[model samples]
Target: MRTDVLHAVRLARLDLTLIGRNTTVLVNVLLLPLLMAWFLTESVGDVEIAGVDGRLFVLTGMPGLIPGFAVFVNLVNSFTARREELVLKRLRGGQPSAAAVLGGSALGALALYLGQVALVAVWAGRSGGLVPANVPLLLLAAVLGVVLFCLLAAAFSGITPNAELAQVTVLPVLLVMLLGAPIAFPADTLPGVLGTVSHLLPATPLVEIMRTAFLGGDHVSGDGAALSMAGQWLTALPSFAVLLIWIAVAGVLARWLFRWEPRRG
Candidate 1:
């Protein structure tokens, strides 16, 4: 919050340049959405999932996916790697508080997410796609999702011994998205257990947020009206809360757990 602290975060974020970072950012922001949308736009063409036309189901699944890719790929990995390298350690030991280091990383990720969203919206609109029904809610979901993932990513990095393993730390989250969630199939077609499980995952609400936005519906993906409302709030609030908690927990853990110079053992 202080001027000096803000300056430090800015400096730290600026130093996060890597070759694969560029490629990962590009693919997440550009190619993933296009490929998903294209799959939706095209016919199912004999494809069938959960007894429904595969393409239709996949289309319904695409909106939610935007959030998942945004979090795990766009924010989570980079934040963790930054922390794993003791970037946070160095910053905290210096003039910057832990907050500043995390804040700067968050701002960087948000900038990327917004930029990518803008590009997607512009290109999709010019191509005749529909805008989301509720812009405010969708944006809220996107931002909240980023905030949660950022802290969780940073916290998880504490368990990582080196920067190279940050990818492994974040890998399971990505795997969950690819496996049981909407990204895997149309919401309607997922079996009872998978549907139930997907609804429970952290990424579920994020995908639901995008799905509701694009499909022009509420994030109420269930039978109970109250339940749907609860689900929506559950996804957003907890997703955001867990991350801040993780930040606190991780900040403390890093005091002991994080090693600046690699251990020889």
Candidate 2:
């Protein structure tokens, strides 16, 4: 047990070092998201919807946007790079379990994602946007977002043929989360059909749940009023359920299709 833990830690450290040394990856993983959040919030400055402040809405959505990109998009590329280079195969021959090896490699990206979550909380709290009315719920939503997307990254990474193709393959899901989800625009701003489609994506519920924690309210109506459709505990249930269903399906696909080695050309 001790040995396994140590091995995982070492692998995590190795990932951290390698990731840290790469300036472009660091910018994309960390700086780009921060810039995106800053631009959107500034552009949409000091508005409100359904009695929930628009600034708060934007802040609440950051966890979904920032971490989704970092964990899912960034790690997909990282995992594919490692696999194409035979790093995963080599690691499998040694002490760490497959889970440990992947977990360790992911530690850096995970930390970055969690750090962004904390940044969102702190920035919102300090800026007087919204402090989470339910801190635990906020944290749960954030953590779940990271986990779901991380699982997705793993699943997608394995099937990606090489580092270059990872960029292309990651686009569909990334687009879903970025453009379709509430990250770029509010759920209410989207047309009904588009909103429903966005709701089906994993990011939609997580953002809604996080917003619920901050706003301390349920569904926001089109006219900027908070509706009573869901109470505190039940606020994010529908979205959560959708995410869970996706998670289950993605997990199955990942398990079935995930490859430790590059496919033969």
Candidate 3:
């Protein structure tokens, strides 16, 4: 790595440490989700995910989701906040590439994601019932998903003008995922057009990837639906490929159009 890249990495580590101190990030990353899961377990008490009657599936889904959400929320918020603060301006003036700055910010969130993963694993193991499956694919899908969303968030932030608008800027993407019910329902059962559209969202494939890994036979993925619902097995691959395409296109757009300047300029 270049000296600048190394410096950026160091900066990212420091920031991540500071984030551990920041209550806002701490609450969002750790407290809220844990509380949600505890309450969910109390309310539902041994509910199922796609027929998997175990806490393992629930834990797997929860941990698998953290990175995607963290990448989406953290990278964009941090990037835009720094941009509005002229941190990007100072760094660029000192010769750091946009890539370095972005990577630096992402490193912190990635670290947090990994930490969350470990905690979730411990929690799930202690909870008993169900077991995590296809560990390799689960890990791969998570890393890829994080990479994809971090860039998407940055791309969204690149076009945003100020901190106040960061949440608004991210709202559309969040709302689409929300509307599609990435967390609540199976995407396979969505209306045709809606399902097709969900195919384009970053979280869609990641969730399916998880469903396939953890839920296994119980998994009702769009990929699987293409085979049974439409009698075409090949549709799954293409649909999955679209996510990679989104990653590429969004990454390039983020690199090309992400701005560091205040909008009033």
Best by lDDT: 2
TM-score list, all predictions: 0.68, 0.88, 0.80
Quantify how close model 3 is to the true structure by its C-alpha RMSD in Å: 4.5
Question: lDDT of all the models against the reference?
Answer: 0.56, 0.74, 0.64
lDDT of 1 by residue, 1-265 (tens): 5776666567546734542367766676457766766765574555764433444435544545554555445544555555556665676788766566666766666665665566656544555464545566568766766666665555555566665676677678777766766654544456888767776666666666654554453334422122243444453454345434544664565455544333345
Candidate number of the best TM-score = 2
Worst 10 residues of 1 by lDDT: 218-227
Candidate 2, residue 113: CA error in Å?
1.0
| Candidate 2: segments with Cα more than 4 A from true spot | 1-6, 184-189, 219-230
Q: What is the alpha-carbon lDDT for the whole of candidate 3?
A: 0.64
lDDT of 2: 0.74
lDDT for each residue of candidate 2 in 1-265, tens digit (9 for 90 to 100): 7777788788777877876899988888888888888888887877775565667668777776776677887888888988889988998887788878766755666677777777888888888755667777777776677767777888988788899998898888877777887764557677779877877778877877777776677642223234343465575677677768877877887787778898788
